[model samples]
Target: MPNPKIFDLTPPDLSDYIAYPILIVSHDAGGASVLAAWVERHLDVGQCDFLLEGPALRYFSGLKIEDSQRHSRTSLVPSEVSRFACVITSTSGEDVSLEREYIQQCRLLAVKVLSMLDHWVNYVPRFCIDGRLCWPDLLMVNDVYAQQLLVAIPGAPPSLLFDNYYLQQQVAQVLQYRKSSALESTQILSRRILYVSEPSTDSRYNEFELLERFLNSIFNYDYFNTQQLQVRVRLHPREKLGKYDELMFHTFSEYSINYCKNELYHSLAWSNTVVGAQTTPMVIALYAGIEVYSCLPEVVEKMTLPFDKIRRIY
Candidate 1:
């Protein structure tokens, strides 16, 4: 159970609006991670039913929920949604329209809907589907930064602050890993960097191009030997395999490059430095006390990440 006093701004009690047998929906990994952490911390496992798709299914798989169901984009029907008192969904960047569809259905049925925002960018576009806005009754955010962003939007739904239990849990894991390894200092002779990759949505440069620029800039530095520098590219859950293979082969062929196959904590533990363009893992790496860098190359867009510790290498 979550301690209510932890937050300076207390959100309304779930019991006030949410009834038993609540439905939780998420399609992307980022939203799924937030919703899953909230569920583990706040909700009773017996009273929640999860409707998950894509990477969300993987995130919720470890939960001991008996009523969880995995569905394709179109398989879940509107009739099934009427059974729940309220619907909770995570805003997704993917092209899937199921979340908007659910919000539409919930609106017609007069059931309350709560939507959670996982990232800072794309505040309004996430709820817009097919030129129609499917605004929820209430919006939830984990940080003041996200809440401020939501509140700035004209006629945006009421936003509430909640603890980012997912990030908190990850930070704890990273700290424990550090303590167990007894790693007081990073190895100076060899440098291990984990490049966390995300699909380029709003960036002027594509993911591959940005990565290429990052590699080129770092390689030009005269201090480190090429053999001693290792890079492991960790792909986003939405990204497909072999997405960066061509770039790895042709552009950064001389460097030691490989895909990260380990879990997130293990991968972070293996590296002294982490790089990405406004991805959540980079924030996690920053919290873990790893040297973090943002690789935005010639992009005119302002950096969305609110952390000052993340050095902009571009």
Candidate 2:
């Protein structure tokens, strides 16, 4: 489905197309963030009439369900949705079979399912972000972002996409950073560090083991022991792992974590590293200049990386 490269935007290109309320879907929080930013810009450029996005597609990495639900603009379906983008995207959880089924229902009503949004198509989206006057079939992006995307969809091309990793990353970052009113005293990634996991292989608990170990290693500073330290851990959104009273690890794999805090580029900058298995975070971390480590031991040794630096992947 790869098309010859075309660099210029033409009027004839968009004449037959209509934004027709887009519904964005994905397990990637960062992917949602990119869409939000793109939509706002697209609206400003008068691209589509109105883009209708679902709840999970717009959520940031961190936050409580209650807080996110309270925002009317962010809510997926309040009362009416004329047209939307239905993205059946996710890396960890099995594809939302229900959401995929709903795609046709929404499309029958005029919503569009944008399958390709290769963020790494040509270049990183400069916040000088502009609107997509015409919906992109194979949205061109940068090689950097493209590298990250390959992890999520191995065969995926930088210009050819099946999901939005940008929004997913955004949601993850927001959820990781946002503090709910619950005031639960749990220490989280305060340092310039990154938490990594390999969802394509290990189970949720296995990731938890490494996460707890990582946290204990970092939090138990000069004066603290593992027991004395309080850590904030954002588990893989794909891992609806069991509850963690034993550790302050936040389980976000089951339900989408709430919160739309910042753009993917900005938040990624804060993390010292990007951790994942066959997931896209590693590529993103590299693009954002954050170090990346593959938690999936099996793949770590086999995959090629641009930099010599490699993760344990175990």
Candidate topping lDDT: 1
Q: Write the per-residue lDDT of candidate 2 for residues 71-134, one digit (tens) a residue.
A: 2334544223443342222211233232233333444465433332333322222111133122
Identify the runs in model 2 with alpha carbons over 4 angstroms from their true place: 1-16, 20-30, 44-93, 105-112, 116-192, 196-206, 209-232, 237-274, 278-281, 299-314
How much lDDT does candidate 1 score?
0.80
Clashing residue pairs, backbone N/CA/C < 3 A, model 1: none
Deviating ranges (above 4 Å) for candidate 1: 1-13, 67-75, 182-186, 221-227
Give one digit per residue, the lDDT tens place, for model 1 in 53-126: 78888888778866444444466676568888888898788487767778888888888888888888887778
Residue 180 shift from truth in candidate 1, angstroms? 2.5
Candidate 2 structure lDDT:
0.38
Judge candidate 1 at residue 267 and give its lDDT: 82
Q: Once model 2 is optimally superposed onto the true structure by TM-score, how far is the C-alpha of residue 64 displaced, in angstroms?
A: 21
Q: Pick the candidate with the highest TM-score.
A: 1
